[model samples]
Target: MENKDSKSEMIKSMAFRLFLDRGYDATTIRMLSRAAGVEAPSIYHYFGSKKGLFYAISESYLEDYQELLKESMKHWGADPMNQILGFVKFAVWYTMNHIDETKFYLRYRLFWPAELSEDMEKHFHKTNDQKEDLLRDAIRVCIETGSCKVDEQTAYRSLINFVDSCTFNIIFSNWRPDEQELIETWQLFYQSRIKLGKGDFEL
Candidate 1:
């Protein structure tokens, strides 16, 4: 069972790298099998189809990303501003460190075959809602604690758009901002636009 699990993980890892490098339309089962050092049938045995493999990879990557966000929230304590900043920092660092996963997620998150589109959309939204809830909860605390004065819906949307924009600029564009630049950008957005507090929140 352990060996089977290891082999399955190896296949998924290779498939993820290939999907990241070559994209979903370009990557083939032969490429994945060769890269994974496994028989072509084994790919079917593990994932049923290329799309299935892709779905599995997406699911696993999202799960890991969610856990990282949760950890960032936990590590930064109850201060809403600090939690938000910590999550942003962690997200920027994670994107740089896990370029392939980031690329895969950004590019292919909404791309799916017609038959799987509904299911994929539901799954994606479910995960996204969980992530949004974290931010919404933090913003609610901010409002309650007098850290910031913003409606939860508006604040959450702005924060989401801000983070997505920052991440998109970092990953998809040629001009890459360094760690400090990314951190500062996040801080500036909150401090300037959101008017998070009268004093600077520790980043």
Candidate 2:
């Protein structure tokens, strides 16, 4: 069982590196096998096909994001604003730690085989929408408690869209810099836009 787990992990690590370094289309079983130090046919034995491998990579990345978000939500029992901030921190931290995974997903989400990409998107968006719904529920509670003054769904959607744009831009902006600068500037940006209400803070 331990060897099986190790081999499986080796396959996934090699597959991720190959898919990122070589475009998915340019990567082949023989090449992956060579890089992974396995026999040419061994990759198929592990992953079934290149498509399956890509899907697994995509799923693994998305699952990491989902798990982080869920973990962040643990502190947010009944507060909308806190819930939103928890999500923001999770997005920032996860993207910072898993930069390669973010790069792999953002680059290849729509580039690989169409069917596989579509299926991957479907699964990702389902989890994404579930997270948004949780945020929306918190928004509804806030509205009921008079803590915020906006339509619940609109606040939820607006906040989510803004955060999603920031998260993706931070990951794929091509502005390579110190992670501290990136995270600090982004946190500042979020504070100005989403955390502070419109006209709530001075530049």
Candidate 3:
């Protein structure tokens, strides 16, 4: 059973790398089998189809991301701004640490197989809604406490867009800011928007 689990994980890891490097449409079962040192039939036996393998990889990655987000939120204190900063720090650190998975998610997230796209969309929406709600609640607290000057909705949207774009550039583009540099840059921007006094909350 242990050997079987190891072999299955090996296949998934190899397939994930291939999909990251060569993309989903260009990757084939023969290539995956060769990379994983498994028979072609084993791929089908394990994953049923190429789409099944991709879905499994994507789901696993998203699950990891969700856990990281949840864990980050647990460390938040009374300050909503601190909570937001904590979330961003975890996000940036995760992207830098898991560049391959981040690249895979960015590249193939919207290009899933037709049969799976609708289901994937629903799953993604559900996951995103949870994150959105968390951010919205934090932003609301910031507004209520007079720490943030922007409206809750606008602040939430802007922060999400800014973080997503910055992280995407850090992963996919030539930008290679270190973890501290990324965190500090975001902290500066966020502090400028809010009414927080200097040294109130360290990023």
Candidate 4:
């Protein structure tokens, strides 16, 4: 017999897989229960309802990604270039390793969340701010070290937008060129747009 915690984990894992395979709308409780190898009521026992299961799945992604960001920050005393590269690699590995979770996050957390309550939306926004702040800190480090000359806030926002565009291409890699080529393109784009003033600019 599985422990309650084990049962809850099973429900969440099965629900996530089913969500990826069948989509959030198409995945039914019965189907999820069958995949979890438990009775339908058992799923309700653990998750309360289908909406509860969906919330668990959505929140799990945010929590896990936030944890990753926190962990990265713990070791981020390095240069901005290394920090950005490390983050890029981590993001790629994370997205590839947790494709289902990434898809759910992209769908519900990032893009479509019409059914989510305002509180839930605010929760995601707040949680996302943690990671965004970390990235900003990295850019600030660059500015302080004279490696970058852009305004901290504007540079951070631009970096995030650029990274998101790159990540979106990776997410849709089926239509994208090779990862190396994509990353190279991003490097050139960033270098040209984000000048490394190296203490030369007076303004």
- Which parts of model 3 are misplaced by more than 4 Å? 110-115, 173-184, 191-203
Poorly placed runs, candidate 2 (over 4 Å): 110-112, 146-153, 172-203
Writing each residue's lDDT as its tens digit, candidate 3 over 60-173 gives 888988888887778877687788887777777788788887777777665775656677677577568877887898889889878788787768876786678777777767
Better of 1 and 2 by TM-score: 1
Which pairs of residues collide in candidate 4? none
Q: What is the C-alpha lDDT of each candidate?
A: 0.77, 0.69, 0.78, 0.71
Whole-model alpha-carbon lDDT for candidate 2: 0.69
Separately for all candidates shown, the number of backbone clashes (residues 3 or more apart, or on different chains) is 0, 0, 0, 0
Q: What are the per-residue Cα lDDT tens digits for candidate 1 across 1-203? A: 45988999999999988888787778889999999999999999989999889889889989988887777667898777877887777777777777778877777665664556677777688668877777878888888887666677767877777777767766767436777777777767787556643333322
Ranking by lDDT: 3, 1, 4, 2
Of 1 and 3, the candidate ahead on TM-score is 3
29 in model 2: Cα distance from truth in Å? 1.4
Best prediction by TM-score: 3
**Relative to the unseen true structure, what is the Cα RMSD of model 3?**
4.5
Candidate 4 per-residue C-alpha lDDT over 80-132 given as tens digits, one digit per residue, 9 for 90 to 100: 76677667656766766666677767766555434555646676786777767
Model 1: residue 192 alpha-carbon error in angstroms: 3.3
Residue 81 CA error for candidate 3 (Å)?
0.9
- Please report the TM-score between candidate 1 and the true structure: 0.80
- Can you write out model 2's per-residue Cα lDDT over 1-203, one digit (the tens) per residue? 44866886788899899888887878888888888788866677767888877777777778877777777778866666667666666666666677788778667754655546557667568666877787787777777776556676656766666555655766767434365664575456545544443533221
